[model samples]
Target: SIYRMNFAASLCKRVNIRELVTNVPAYAGATELSGGGLALVFRRWATKKTAGSTKNGRDSNPKNLGVKKFGGERVIPGNIIVRQRGTRFHPGNYVGIGKDHTLYALKEGNVKFE
Candidate 1:
């Protein structure tokens, strides 16, 4: 009995899976309902997102979002630090920016935002 229990535990350890899930069928339901409370058609509804206008008169484009990477953060060669729409922060050694004002690292080093 102890040997069998140990064997089962070893099999469980060998098959070390974290989780298991079952695939669900969409857009379909049971044709015949056991409970007599099925009158309407069972279907999935779709949702839509609305992009409302801003109260401030400025257009939402070219937000000039600055500083993806901050000061003293370790970065590898060719890591994008920040993406912006304008020339907010200039590039230094081992750092560069694109034509669209996207700042990135040219070399592997610690980031220094100034």
Candidate 2:
């Protein structure tokens, strides 16, 4: 005789940068998860900078500044874990890995990953 069991699993909605920072528990600027997972975080702020003059010489709000990078160790559950090398981007936008890795832009406002 054979017995069968069915298990139901739920998927978590992917969270955007803003929501990831505010909603996730113990969320720091940048965090490395044990088990080969990485979290990139940032805050909202604005500033003005000087750029090429538009016929009239003047400074303007040319750039927006925000958190650039955060560092942490990678861990393995129930085992020894090591921090793998990685790279982060500015504007609290994206993360890249390995040489010649393609760049990804973060969603503007609250974004959800599937």
Say which candidate scores most in TM-score. Answer: 1
Superposing every Cα of model 1 onto the true structure, what RMSD results? 24.5
Model 2: which residue pairs collide? 14-113
Measured on C-alpha atoms, candidate 2 has an lDDT of 0.34
Deviation in Å, model 2, residue 19 alpha carbon: 16
For 1-114, candidate 2 gives per-residue lDDT tens digits of: 122222222234454566444343345433444323344445555767868657866678844332222234222222211113233332223332324232233322331221
User: Which candidate comes out best when scored by lDDT?
Assistant: 1
TM-score of 1: 0.42
User: What's the C-alpha lDDT at position 15 in model 2?
Assistant: 47
Please give the range of 10 consecutive residues that has the lowest summed lDDT in model 2: 74-83
